[model samples]
Target: MPNLNFEFTEEFALKMDQNDPLRSYRDQFYFPKVNGRDALYFCGNSLGLQPKSVKTYLEKELENWANLAVDGHFEGEDAWMYVRQKSKPALAQILGAHPHEVVAMNNLTSNLHFLLVSFYQPKGERTKILCEAGAFPSDQYALESQVKFHGLDPEETIVELAPRAGEHILRTEDILAKVKEIGSSLALVMMGGIQYYSGQLFDMKDITAAAHGVGAYCGFDLAHAAGNAPLKLHNWGVDFATWCSYKYLNSGPGNISGIFVHERFADDQSLPRFAGWWGHDEGQRFLMEKGFIPMHGADGWQLANSNILALAAHQASLDLFAQAGMEQLRAKSEKLTGYLEFLIDEISGNSGILEIITPRTASERGCQLSLLIHKGGKAVFDSWYAHGVVGDWRNPNVIRLAPTPMYNSFLDVYRFGKILEQSLHDFA
Candidate 1:
């Protein structure tokens, strides 16, 4: 964590922004307007602001489609047939995996089902899957359905772990102990890289190790952690993982999702998978082959051709990530979120109306700070929205604010503090 004395003043924020190395990147994005002004956007965790370059990127594909028509698949430099490769290097860097280990494909939930077919092979007594309770609802539904598809009762086959008592976050030790207790019965250990509601980043490497120790396959739904947190999925020895590109990656809404499969599975043709023509060997794909000779790596998971326009928009943001680098972005993220935490603590003082439920330690969280509101929660959130503050309110009492390092600045956080202070007063 970069330790710097934080002050709750406008001038101090101005100074911090003026000195920020990543400040210029903020201008590269288009912010939504509220009340004739650019809104303070702290909702990147839900949906990211569009990159200015997305227009040009999309137009390029549209031109290729209009000009080349059928030839566009193999004609120009950015051929539609192989466009997925363009984002590989940047995706590899973001995921900390070999290029062959990761590939952009179907949506998050769809990919999860595909991966479960390959990894969640329950045999004999080893028929259990462990995951966090209250995972994103889609994951819950997918897991439940997958277990049911295998003729197992979800209540008996899937274990959902929750934070103990009133705690909002799971301790790493408790997770490991649970893995040990499950022992050989656990066929899979599936979890989110970061808990969506609590904004807690899990110890994925440790969890993976513990799962392997118990002879179970480990994977993660990295929808919240993908570009926001530092991940070395290859080094962690994780068997499989998947994430959507729309949130922290700033791709358009419901854009493509990427998956990582360890190199150890690269040539394992014996593993059962839901095969498709796109997953077959590229050289033999057009031959109208009768057999499914899977591609050597993560590419083997693809079920269909890439969405050219989506990939174009996705590449626009990935190109920015390649230039900016994840390490530098993560450094700024810590400072931005830390400053937000500091200001929240300072303003909340003895007011018992709001509390930050996100983990305080920098390494244990990303940019999002989930606020647990005790009084006037909805009214306070509405006030912030009316006043040009853009954040998301979860059901019950939490408001999620993500200060993205790519486009958000210290000034944004400072302004949000003023809005929050006033909203609290008005609502109280």
Candidate 2:
């Protein structure tokens, strides 16, 4: 990539914003106001700002429920019985999969457990799960419990891969080497699509291949990746995946999550799954039969009926996504994130006060950048928050800033840089 000849000037940022094709999207979101102005928000990695269309979408569902009640399941605008199907096209587009391979249903963690029930088969020597060390706590718990559920000790049945000594990110070569070395003992290759703390985007295509090569199942927790990076779950030969909608998807907090199961397993009735009435063949669903006949594709994985209100809100965001398109969003994202990285480098300038632990390469990261402050730690993070820079602060000393392509602008990043410079100076 060639340089855009960036400069540390408000004029430059304003000019960049003026030239941005996606500039008008900023008005579609509800931002938190600081001192009566929109705060410089860079925490989409944690929780995205709500889209303005959410109210209208929710109201439509409310009206149907008020007038129809139980009839809402068959009548009215989303047809509560199959409301989640409406999000399939957009979800498929974002995930790079066929519509049947994707479904919007339970929360991320719950879906992870549900998928594990079928994918994590512990038998013979291949009974251990492989994952990244220091993964999100919820993932840690799920993996540990899954091991215990099979009457296996997590300590002996879980293989955790970590970064090399004195490094903040894991190397792809090391990860693959470990996969090969632990081949017969590994039963699954599960990890975040993008690391939550370091913000590293693993080479999932390669990782999936390695897992398959070892005869182990592969999956991903895309909580930090789905809308932030380009995904090709189907083409990548990934067995399964799951993600939260509240982060990059911009749905409301605690909104439903998405799941992906490869087409190969779509009609694999031999696979063991925790059966549910909702997953029974739709044609016979109301029959209330004694035998469970699973639906085809990702829908078969669903355990409950659609959450009409949540799907409505999710559908609202996915509408914007469909109109904007991933190709267009990603083109702008690379530039916006690259510009933020450039600005951070310019501000730090050999100061040894902070270091970027996230990968510097565009191919290895997404919207978020994790800055590890060497000196000020939490106090500096608190000052940044006080000054209206809404970024995610982790324990010890790391601040995660994500310049979301949907609602964030170059001017927002520039304003954030100024606040950061002020905080560093004040706390120096």
TM-scores, one per candidate:
0.99, 0.98
Instruction: Please provide, for model 2 over 127-221, each residue's C-alpha lDDT reduced to its tens digit, 9 standing for 90 to 100.
Output: 98889999999899999999999999999888899999999999999989999999999899999999999999999999999999999999999
- The local distance difference test score of model 2 is 0.91
Model 2 poorest ten-residue lDDT run = 1-10
Each model's Cα RMSD: 0.9, 1.0
Superposed by TM-score, candidate 2 places the C-alpha of residue 301 at a distance from the truth, in angstroms, of 0.7
Highest TM-score scorer: 1
Cα miss at 356, model 2 (Å)?
A: 0.6
**385 in model 2: Cα distance from truth in Å?**
1.4
TM-score of 1: 0.99
> Candidate 1, residues 1-428: lDDT per residue as tens digits?
54489999999899989988889899999999999999999999999889999999999999999999999999998988888889999999999999999999989999999999999999999999999999999899999999999999999999999999999999999999999999999999999999999999999999999999999999999999988999999999999999999999999999999999999999898889999988999998999969899998999989899999999999999999999999999999999999999999888887888989999999999999999999896888898999999999999999999999999999999999898788767766
